[model samples]
Target: MLKFVKNHMESIEGVATYPMISLLIFFVFFALLFWWVFTASKAYIKEVSELPLENDNNQPKEDLL
Candidate 1:
């Protein structure tokens, strides 16, 4: 099974570049995300962190009839 797949890939031209390009893309994406996380504002972080517990609709709850 492995030999069959390797033989098939060996027939294609420029197949080797595909793995390098994919690795470069993956590395750049994660590097940018890491930079953004580190540079983000503390205040903004705190606000986002509290989103799950925040109640936007302040109206009083109506009693069930």
Candidate 2:
């Protein structure tokens, strides 16, 4: 299976650049994500973190017959 894939990949033109471009894109995306996480507001993060524990009383009460 490995040999088959390797042989097929070698047949494609410009296949080498594809891996490089994909790697660059992956690196850039994670870098931006890390920057955003570090620079995000503490209050916003606190609110988001507490979202699951806060009850807004939005749920409808179920009627028991």
Candidate 3:
């Protein structure tokens, strides 16, 4: 199976660039994610973290009429 995949990949033009492009995309995505996590507001993070623990009963009721 490995040999079959390797044979097919070798036939494609510019296949050498594929791995580099994939690596660049992976690195950029994680870097942006790390930056967002660090730059996000503490209050916003706390609110999001406690969302599941908050009670639905505390929400103001809306009128159906």
Between candidates 1 and 3, name the one with more favorable TM-score.
Answer: 1
- Give model 2's clash tally: 0
Per-candidate TM equals 0.80, 0.76, 0.76
Question: What lDDT score belongs to each candidate, Candidate 1 first?
Answer: 0.85, 0.85, 0.87
lDDT of 2: 0.85
Q: Candidate 1's residue-wise lDDT over 1-65, tens digit each?
A: 99999999999999999999999999999999999999999999988886765455633234221
* Candidate 2 lDDT over residue span 1-65, tens digit each: 99999999999999999989999999999999999999999999987886775456733234221
Candidate 1: minimum summed lDDT over ten consecutive residues — where?
56-65
Better of 1 and 2 by TM-score: 1
Q: Give lDDT tens digits, candidate 3, residues 1-65.
A: 99999999999999999999999999999999999999999999988887776567644234322
lDDT of 1 at 51: 71
TM-score of 2: 0.76
Candidate 2's error at 31, in angstroms? 0.3
Query: Once model 1 is optimally superposed onto the true structure by TM-score, how far is the C-alpha of residue 20 displaced, in angstroms?
Result: 0.4
Q: Locate the minimum summed-lDDT window of 10 residues in model 3.
A: 56-65
